[model samples]
Target: MPMKKKPTNICCFLPDEIVENILHRLPTKTLLKYKIVCKRWKSLISSTSFKRLHENKSLENPVLILFSRQEGKPFLTTVDLSGAVLDRWDLASIGLQNSAFLPSPFGSDNLLCLVVDMQRFFVCNPSTRRACQICLPKASMHCPSGISKASFGYVPDRNQYVIVAKFKGRRNWRMITLSRDDVVVSAGNIDERWKIIKDSARYRVADGSPWGVFADGILYWTGDADDRRCLTCFDLWEEKFFVVLLPDEIVMIQEYQDDDQWLVELNGDLHLMYKKEGQQDIELWKLDGAGDWGWSKQDMCVAGFRARFGAHFRPVMMDEKGEMLVYNGGFMEWYKLKHEVFRMGGKGYKNIHCHAEDVILDFKLHIDTLL
Candidate 1:
């Protein structure tokens, strides 16, 4: 007969770092289950240190979290790859009370941005949980149409940040480039005032491909022209637009081309994942140089996958050791050596709060805007 082994209490024997290493691999849903497995897990996993571990892992495998922008009462819902729920927060309470509006966050390092209203924006660090709100007449003056998207990009030429808000209505709306120098500044003025650079102007997005990613000192947008969808690459340094051809296989779906959906920079290359016609999977295109974008296809999804899923899987910059972290399929998933993938789960954070409109855990990561 097999020896009846006494119940081993290994958790107490292990170091906290070891425990966190194990905990970091669990899916958010599984983490929820593990939290109830025992008191040790419940206490150990809830500490700020454990959260810091997860946060560090997140900066490694940062998951792009999208929340439902409810009108008047705005809130964000997030989902992982395994279709797990994390948490959702009410934006209204945080002074982002425009429910009818869209809140898009661009993330890099510790700084996450939140685009509030049409022109206004905010940047926050999830690890420290500190946020800075943007105050400006330009942001407050412009109100975008119901269907539009906005982005925040850095201009190398000016050594400043720019907020680009794109609005789409009956016609191809306009582009409001909020430059720090554009707003009128008072000479030696102490009160908040800005010096405008370029007056806000409107132009039709070429073929309706809409805005792309801002990468390598460029703000990229997409437009479909002449029955073909192309990437409208804008040079922030020179203020010019360059068009690049998209793969013929990919249909270049319209809905996912919004400001935050497409364009992911992975391993120093831009990845464009889009839906293809009559096919279930999405296309993965890579832009390595200034020339044409290389394309490939990856099924890489179960049911309910989409171009919007790209937003949830944006690549988080690697840590000093060069590892990327992300939440895949509703679980904790991280990248190793630019290709290997791992799942990191947490306790109780899974299924924390979720619904149809709201998916995984609600963790918001925003990008920086013009100040």
Candidate 2:
């Protein structure tokens, strides 16, 4: 007997554990392509354990995900904080048509969550380009008044992705989820159905451009608080609401308008950005519980910022070196708060013209390695 000829299998030589270790580090694009190699490969890649492993590896290096609006269209791009484009993906190719695009893409465990015209929910893997549209449950159907605030977050305890919608009509709360396959469908069963949470507080999120910042399993929004505006905190784990007090100066300014105020989460702490009515200096306040209302203040100066400070420039983030990232619709640059100068000086700060003369720049911290 000729020993039945030694088997010849390229991928079969590696153990399942080794294969999973290598595949988890590969980009989503490559992994999707590899799924067609064989049934074993497909099953392995599609397994929940493999997905959890991939997500864990991806969390290592975070990138800056940019949503640039040009000519009323939205483009999704990823770049490192150092100002280098890594991957550029067109939203149109993924069925994101002429709909009203949400500002920044929300990051979940293994996917990025986006809203279309505030009517549809799209969860996609930025790396693999695999997307699934989640249908809004009937319970979450159009509110007579309107949808005041909507946000998507992941619950680690349940290992599920949830969309929390706050309606303006009855001031009600609707919690919706995607199916096991990640498709949006009307709640079919108890597990996949929408649950309404009764509202207890009189607090409400502001109307226009209310951005949701998810940090430490809680979603934070900048909204109204009686005559003064304040930070709204929603605990995803508890499904409860809490109000965070903004700096005295911030509350005073926000009471007037929303353009000048921004809520951002940096390095796990909530940050509030605001510029007094006539000050050239922009102050960034961080929640400093050890200090005051868990708030600490840092200021930055921009030349002629007061006269030119409309919506073009917004302070979005700060790095460990104390350099702040300033986004101006079309381009992003780092400003050394301590040095009082921008990385590119004046020329480096020049706007990278987009198709739309007026664009909105939204930044979501992305993990470079994950994609």
In the order shown, the candidates' Cα RMSDs to the true structure are: 11.7, 5.6
- The list of candidate 2 runs beyond 4 A from truth reads 1-26, 35-57, 69-73, 79-90, 98-110, 139-146, 177-192, 253-255, 289-293, 299-310, 314-317, 344-361, 368-371
RMSD (CA, Å), candidate 1 to true, equals 11.7
172-239 per-residue lDDT for model 2 (tens digits): 66777553345323343433466677673465777765547666566777776776667777777778
Residue-level lDDT tens digits of model 1 in 1-371: 89898898877688877887998665454565677877888887767666556555654444435545443365654444344444455777877764222223243332445656644555444333345555433335453343354445665455455544444332332233333332322223211443332433333354334334566666566664565666666555665455667766554455443432356655445567554444444445566555545555432432233333444454443345555444443433444433434435441123323454444323434321111
TM match of model 1 to true structure: 0.50
lDDT of 1 at 217: 66
Model 1 worst lDDT window (10 residues): 182-191
Scored by Cα lDDT, where does model 1 land?
Answer: 0.48
